[model samples]
Target: MTDTGWTTERMPDMTEKTVVVTGANSGLGYEVTRALARKGATVVMACRRTNHAKTVKGRILTEVPDATLDVRELDLADRESIRSFAENFEADYDNLHVLCNNAGVMAIPRRETEDGYEMQFGVNHLGHFALTGLLFDRLLETPGETRVVTQSSGVHERGDINFEDLHGEQEYDKWDAYAQSKLANVLFAYELDRRLDEAGIDNVLSLACHPGYASTNLQRRGPEQEGSRIRLWMMRLANAVFAQSAERGALPMLYAATGEDVMGGEYVGPGGLMNMRGLPEIQPSSDRSYDEQMADRLWEISSDLTGVTYDFAQAKAADDD
Candidate 1:
């Protein structure tokens, strides 16, 4: 950890800021929403289930009675849902200060999303990719600094983008799919920063962060989906023994989103033993994640697949004017 041991307490005042957190009903997202709200930010809880998110919002309101929260339905698996959410958000809010692409699934059984893409890759990477593209205009036009923070994982070190068999139709491995998706998150974050710089746009920052080994419902989903009692027990034991609480795990993301010294393209995570649990700090990602060639290829393919190409030139032109 850094000498100062950065924590959420160090976050700047967020009064008047509007933040959107995907999957805000549970785990790290929930913790992030609560913390941002406590700091006086208006948080839009972009969740898949409106009812559950409203309940979570109530929980937050109980803790921070004056917190401002807006629960909106967002299903990352479906492109239509994403578009609708963006449209509704544009109608409801004039400015967006932060977009936290934090919701994700872990190692689960092979499945396809509404658009037929692999579920893990679709929701974790492409979904966020499309969402960011759709709402990037607001980020550019909004006054003052803005941020796009993506959540990745340490397992991303083992990921390889299989261009030939992107969906793993021939050979499927759940962990491999999850790793690929997480890696894509980091790549997208870095590539976005590069594009912003290239376009001479400095008002928006893009970053990626990971919650070391936070104990959350994500780890249990795969085992439960597989109906393996032994695996579920093992996961539970690991969480009990080694994992940190979701609140602690969320610090890295919160720091990335609100830290005064945070920079675009940095990857933040725990600074404890083996980067498993501790205070948030800037860290290096895997060598593969820094490959410009791979990132460019992924960016092109993602835009083609999602049909949501970024219009950075337009933002630059507006700034020039």
Candidate 2:
């Protein structure tokens, strides 16, 4: 099977499979959760706000009467919350087929997470890194081929990892921080795939995708948090005029999750002009995103910062036995 002419309609049956999507309360995350639930996958909506997650879950149930959904609190801005969510999930579920690292904070003003890391980099990149590491065993031990789909953005092209300023301590530009986080996401996904292959793990696939200019609340939150009405309004206007709907924006992720044609280490995005809006297909990202040395360094720093490291050797041994 090739990525050519792929659509959600071609997604195979997902009955009995389990998927976890972070930031599943709204935007692209919500759309992905809904589609997976409709396809008979047991979907867990991992989010920070319990109340908001409940509302989204209710809406999904209304749309798909039989949708199997669970709303779990997962505040990516806090490391403790990430650990707790992963522990609870593993205790309750025997297998996990998909782990979608979809939640993120956009170009918000300078802030710090509960652990004191820069907000954008902490929440968008390190947060997901920890969560994936914590639950990697479950994914590897699952019945069939499992996937880890990390979401990146087009803005990553302009991103560069400032090792000295990973936390933006010396200086901070909101957009620059956000771009770095997105680049980290892409680098992490690709490195993970390479590591998985090196460990001789064939059943687990890691991929990355971007929603080309998707209309989502990600743009509003930064301004709303800063209490800038003008910024919020501008974002809304831009979304209305230039962005595609959340459902369409979520296609690349959905395809990465369910498309048999997709492979580990591949990047998927909209097939339209400049990858802004169209069907999902295999796409190329920024040249810098493919830097193996940078990815290795980032992974090391992430493990040290988050105190969560992936032991692929152990995973491989388990598979061997």
Candidate 3:
């Protein structure tokens, strides 16, 4: 099927599928969860706050009375939390059809995660990297096709991974850090697809997508944290003038997660003016995002920092058994 004007309406039937959506309580993540649940998928709403997720789940159920929803705690800023969530999820669910790495921190001031990594990169890239590795075996062992859809951003075009100071310890620019983390998202997704291909693994696909310019709570976060009223006002103005709805922005990720014609390693985004807002379509990411050497380096460093190594061989062996 052509992805010319793909939207959530074009999504395939998701009966019997189980999806995990991080940050499912709001914004693009919320839209994705609601859409998938409406399509007959049992959605695990992975949020840092369980109470809030439960509230969101209730809201979704009100709209789609038959939607199956599960609220689970997943704090991407903390390694311990990530590990706990993965362990709990593995014990409870036998199948994981789609993992939407949709949770992230945007242009926040320099901060550190529980593991002392930069806040934006930690939560946005490294955290998801670790989670995917932790759940790799489950994805591989699951029957039929499974997907790991990572959320990136359009600002990745301006990113340049600074290996010398990846954490921004030397210097920090909020927007630059955010861009770096986003570029890392695309790199990780493409690298994962290549690795899966090399291992002869066809059941699991890794794809990356961006939400163009969506008006979400993400924009208000940085200024809110810093108590910058003027900055917040500017962001609000920008959103009002240039951004699309979170529901519209979420189309790319939903398409990446469910589109039958989508291929692994493809970067899905808006097909509209300047790629800011429109229907979902396969698009090209930044040239730097395709650097094999950089991706490999990031993967290796991420495994070391997070201590979550992906054992594709073990997963393959388990599948064979």
Leading candidate by TM-score: 1
Residue pairs that clash (backbone atoms under 3 angstroms), model 1: none
In order, what is each prediction's RMSD in angstroms?
Answer: 0.9, 1.5, 1.4
Q: Order the candidates by lDDT, highest first.
A: 1, 2, 3
lDDT per residue (tens digit) for residues 1-321 in model 3: 234778777899998999999999999999999999989999999999889889888999999999999999999999999999999999999999999999999999899999999999999999999999999878987889999999999999999899999999999999999999999999999999999888778899999999999999999999999999999999999999999999999999999999999999999998887899989889889999999999999999999999999887767777667
Off by over 4 Å in 2: 1-3
Worst 10 residues of 3 by lDDT: 1-10
**What TM-score does candidate 3 reach?**
0.98
Q: What is the C-alpha lDDT of each candidate?
A: 0.95, 0.94, 0.94
Winner by lDDT? 1
Model 1 / residue 120 / CA error / Å:
0.2
Write the residue-wise lDDT of candidate 2 on 1-321 in tens digits: 233566678878889999999999999999999999889999999999989999989999999999999999999999999999999999999999999999999999899999999999999999999999999999999988999999999999999999998999999999999999999999999999999999999999999999999999899989998999999999999999999999999999999999987899999999886788888999888999999999999999999999999999999999999
Off by over 4 Å in 3: 1-3
Weakest ten-residue segment in model 1 by summed lDDT: 1-10
